[model samples]
Target: MELVSLNATHPDHGGKSFQKAASVVLHLLVIAALTYQIRGVARLPAHPHIDARILVPYAPGHTAVVHPPKPKIIRPKEEPKLAMKEPPPPPPPSSGGDPTGDADVELAMASFFPDPKPDLAALPHGTRGDIVIDIVIDQDGKVVDTQVDQGLGHGVDEAVLAVLQTWTFYPATKSGKPVPSKQRLLFHFERA
Candidate 1:
């Protein structure tokens, strides 16, 4: 007994293999034609056109569509009735000595004119003179008024007055309160 292999490479089965391959190719060609015919039927020839128009309503026969009335115009009213209360009267004049008689006044005087003695440089050429300035020390410990009693021609008199203006004193007191008092300062100028 002889055995025959059915594979395409086997001599006995080569012609049969060729016939089977041809039938498979013919089946694929028929399937491709059917797919193309179905796709054509599914497509429409032309797209439909749509005409769109936006319509607004026109007022007919004076139809009154009332809108809310405008808010009322309000004017602020003047309140003249409101009045400010008066400030309490100044605290009764402080008790002890004049409140104005404080250490600050003395410090201010010292800072204003540090040198109590007048500089004699103003007098020149052997000029010598004595000046007495009548000064009033006010309650604030400041020299308020200065009257020159003697004159020194070489500007010595004026220099004395100007320097005294910056002088301050423990204003004379009466009954523990600062009081204005008259005092005199004597300046002697003699060139060295």
Candidate 2:
């Protein structure tokens, strides 16, 4: 058998000129795309100039001086004083005289007891009443016992009793000698 040429430019079959032209065109297109991309990357955006003096190394005798911020001082403002009226003086004690008919024994006065305002929040608004309590004062001028003869409820009675227990009284005197005595106290509670 004769040797047959397998060259791409053979005349028995159509030459591959179309393929060669297409390859040349493809190569040209790739070169064009690469050049376009490189040209776009070569351009740089405008930016502000930065001073690099702080990055410089300091010399032996020339040192950089840095100052710390000063501290702030603050002062408090004064509050205004309010004008309020003083409470009225307590009433004098009743002169019911001693039950044993001891003329020398003086009864306890209303002023001797402290005037602690009861917590009226438990009671209705504008509620007012009297709470009578009988207290025994020892010869040492301390309340030894207390009995609620009358009470204005809503926890007011307990509050009053607790405050009275801490009070120190002036003991009664019989023939100029200190003696334990029993006295009745009247506390009037009025809501303000």
Q: Name the TM-score of candidate 2.
A: 0.44
Q: List the lowest-lDDT window of 10 residues for candidate 2.
A: 36-45
What TM-score would you give candidate 1 relative to the actual structure?
Answer: 0.38
Residue pairs in candidate 1 whose N, alpha carbon or C atoms collide under 3 angstroms: none
Local distance difference test, per candidate?
0.61, 0.72
Top candidate on lDDT is 2
Give the C-alpha miss distance for residue 75 in model 2, angstroms: 98
Candidate 1: where are CA atoms >4 Å away? Answer: 1-113, 116-124
How far off is model 1, as Cα RMSD?
26.0
* lDDT against true structure, model 2: 0.72
Residue 16 lDDT, candidate 2, scale 0-100: 79
